[model samples]
Target: MMTLEEFKEKNYGKRGNTERDELEAGYENFKIGALIHDTRLEMGMTRHNLQKK
Candidate 1:
């Protein structure tokens, strides 16, 4: 099987391409959201609790 980088290159074009850049930005946003979610869970904060703060 191809690596993730190779798969991205084959399906999305090189890093500088507009589609690739947008995909990368989306992935970064997802990563940030995941990190925040995990942190909130670790802190024993539910969504409602977080919203209160």
Candidate 2:
């Protein structure tokens, strides 16, 4: 298997545009999860407390 450097070099080409583009497409769910997690922390809420609003 290629090292991460080699893999990134192969898939991301010179400027990392391909991998960055792919990551951009998948970033929304992560953003939402982080927002929810941060809000829960701010509100002192547990995962159990936040279920199904």
Candidate 3:
């Protein structure tokens, strides 16, 4: 898990700081969602099953 501070430092660029931060945040969330999806598949669970639980 990356803290916001770490992300900020790693993503800092010459311009578009705000846009880059937002993009990084979105990418991080997407990564987390992908991990969750992969874990469910590994456990032989469908999205429907996860939603019902």
Candidate 4:
């Protein structure tokens, strides 16, 4: 798995284009959200469970 910095460098740095930059940002956000969801699920934690903390 790519670290966020590596992902950004490959997708949004000097070699990147405007369209790709936007898409990469969105993709990054989606990946973060999915990771959070997956982690929570694995821990048997729901939104409400999280909110209680």
Whole-model lDDT values for every prediction: 0.97, 0.77, 0.83, 0.82
Candidate 4 local lDDT, 29-53, one digit each (tens): 9999999899999999999997897
Q: Backbone clashes per model, in order?
A: 0, 0, 0, 0
* TM-score (C-alpha) between model 3 and the true structure: 0.68
Ranking, TM-score, top scorer first: 1, 3, 4, 2
Question: How well does candidate 1 score on lDDT at residue 31?
Answer: 100
lDDT of 1 by residue, 1-53 (tens): 99999999999999999999999999999999999999999999999999999
**Model 4 RMSD, rounded to 1 decimal:** 6.0
Cα error, candidate 1, residue 21 (Å) = 0.5
User: Between which residue pairs do clashes occur in model 4?
Assistant: none
Instruction: Residues 2-47, candidate 2: write the lDDT tens digits.
Output: 8966765676654448775675556777899999999999999999
lDDT of 3: 0.83
Better of 3 and 4 by lDDT: 3
Runs off by more than 4 Å, candidate 2: 1-21
Instruction: List ranges where model 3 is wrong by over 4 Å.
Output: 1-16
> What TM-score fits each model?
0.94, 0.54, 0.68, 0.62
lDDT tens string, model 3, 1-53? 99886766677742368877677789899999999999999999999999999
Best by lDDT: 1
C-alpha displacement of 2 in model 3, angstroms? 23
